[model samples]
Target: MTEFDILVVGEANPDLLLRGDVRPRFGQEEQLLTAADLVLGGSAAITAVGCATLGLRTALLAAVGDDFFGALVRDQLTTAGVRLMPYAAGGVPTGVTVILSEPDDRAMLTLPGTIAALRPQDVTDALIQSTRHVHVSALYLQPGLAGGLAEVFKRARSLGRTTSLDTNWDPSGAWASLDDILAHTDVFLPNAAELSAVTGAANPDTAAAQLVALGTTVVMKDGARGARAWWPDGEAAAPGRPVDVVDTTGAGDSFNAGFLAGRLGGHDLPESLRWATVAGSLSTRAAGGTAAQATRADLMP
Candidate 1:
């Protein structure tokens, strides 16, 4: 039997959220922010935490600098019950994102730092062999991992491990190279915008169909509208749960965690979609990605 239920391979960073009504004028004048705080901020890390919270045996394999921010990241993940196999990069600073939050939406300024330095070798064969599922996230942030991700997923499949990918908004806008990875991905989780962007399709249905043609199950997430899943056999959708909105950071990752937990536990697609929607909505109830995450008991229908 595998030692871990899920292995998350991706970035780890701390988010510095600045909540306020005022915008910076950029003239070097002092602008006071209403509130500021640091919280867990990487897509992969958030998903790993969510999975562990839902009672999955989860591990995170990523890179972080041996610095203050890195320490914070480790503490948060460890507290959330996620085993860490993190590389400590010397000299490089730990990655950090500055999120300027408004009432409706937010903008982020990110420093790549150690997040961009993750390599393929970090995901060893031994790791893949010991996990029942593998999840890859933040494709564009880590060029080294992105280059060899296809082979990684293929090898995982060969070892009888299912795989999932969440290529969170590519900053470079070059979404053409993910087809190879999708060939080995069992679950492809993308937001409606990401689905459209990656496939160049005008609609979510077309985007999902294109991914389905690539031999992967496609789950298109639409915030507030819930999620839709397309498999070879059939397609299903779940309506979004109503919730008072806060920060939407890592909501998609939380959804991925919920869906994967249900799938690994033998739940059907529609049931998994329901859990996913619940998780996503609940995540937005707090100011940070992980604060309002639901536990397994809380998610029980």
Candidate 2:
């Protein structure tokens, strides 16, 4: 057995969430009608925390500056039982995200900060060889790291470790190197829009097929509608579990964590999806991104 169940590679940051009725215009300001909170975020933060909460022996490889935000991030990860490796330079500032959410929707403004410093050298071979699953996240934003990251995944595959990817955001939608990354990805998780953007597919089925053609197992997430997985064996659809949603920020991460947890525990694809949907639904009941993330007790089966 591997020493760690999952190793997440990405960026870590602090997030400021303003909840309730308050809107900020381009040139105008607004008054707060609700409350605000400071919490941990970034793709790696949410995914690693979710994995740990789901009873996985999780390890995180991310860059964090030598500033206040970085300190807080380290402390929070430590409290969450995530093993962290040093990856940032001294004196740099950690990344941050400012989120404004109303009763029905939310918008965000993110500063990459030290997150931009994350490079391929930060992903050590020992770490890759030690984990059962190695997940690479937020590829689009770190174009510089993408190529090298691909090499790491390729090496991990050669070592027999399962590889997964979460292409979190693609603001530009240009995937000049996406195929290279997918070639080494055993599992590829992308939201509907991101799938369309990456595969240029008019619909979900085509997009999923396109990803599988690139040699990856596709897990396509469609908000509200549900999620599906496609591989050489064909496709399996998993309906979304209904819930009283409070926030949707960490839903996807929680879903991934739950799915991986189920897989590690020898569950079938459908069973994994069921656990994933439940975990995602549970994550919406709190304030921050991972606020409602479920533990082993919350995810029975």
Candidate 3:
């Protein structure tokens, strides 16, 4: 048997969620009104937690420091049943994202310590060959790995393991250098905004068409309305699951987990999309991403 059902290679960090009037002011103004929480963050870490919750044998390979936050991250991952591998990196402190959150939206200030420390070489050929699937996230945040991810994906493909990418948002606005990676990527997961930005095709429909032409299955995550997926031959969609909103910190990452776990577990496209939408919607019921993540029982008919 394979050592892992899925291997997630990306950033791992913690999020400090601050609620209430989060609008910051200058001159060191003192402002407070609500609650604060420190929770497991990072796209890869959250997704791994979700996958494990859904009963996948998940493992995470990411860099972090030997600091308190890193220890917290490792502890949370362990508690969530995700196998943490090679957790420490030298020189940098562990990364953290301070999320100033409202129910529907949020702003984040990030300290990219070991977040940017993951390199392509860290994902060895042995690691790729040991897993049934490979999933990567937060592409723009890890330039070292982002620069060489296409090669890594190529290796994964060559070994017969499937691959996926959730590039997240490209902060530079350029949205360049992804065509090569997408060529080797079997599944391309992006939000509508990220889809539009990456493909520059005016709207989601056009962007999905453009990307499917590159031989990638585009799964566009549209909040509230739902998510849609397009393969080269056909298309499918799933409506959003309505829920009481809390924080939207890691909903997208959870959606990724739902879709991936569904498909890997042999569900069809429409069913997988249902898994994704439900997982995404339910995740917002808590302060941080993984707090309210869906379980396999929660996802069943």
lDDT of each: 0.90, 0.82, 0.92
Model 3 Cα lDDT, one tens digit per residue, 186-283: 99999999998888777788889988988999998999998999999899999988898888999999999999999999998889989999999999
Q: Quick one: best TM-score, which candidate?
A: 3
Weakest lDDT window of 10 consecutive positions for candidate 2: 24-33
In what order do the candidates fall by TM-score, top score first?
Answer: 3, 1, 2
| lDDT for residue 92 in candidate 1, whole number 0-100 | 94
lDDT of 1 at 285: 88
Per-residue lDDT tens digits for candidate 2, residues 1-301, read: 7789999988889989888775765666656557788999887789899999888999998888888999999999999999987663666788898888775678878887877777787777788888998987788766667868778888888889989999787756566658888889988888888788888887888878877888888887777777888887877877776788777876788888888888888898877877877787788888786777988887785
Q: What would the per-residue lDDT of candidate 1 be over residues 219-266, giving only the tens digit for each residue?
A: 989999999999988999998889988788889999999999999888
Ranking of candidates on lDDT, top first: 3, 1, 2
Model 2's alpha-carbon lDDT is 0.82
TM-score per prediction, in order, is: 0.97, 0.95, 0.98
How much is the lDDT of residue 72 in candidate 2?
Answer: 93
> Residue 9 in candidate 2 has what lDDT?
87
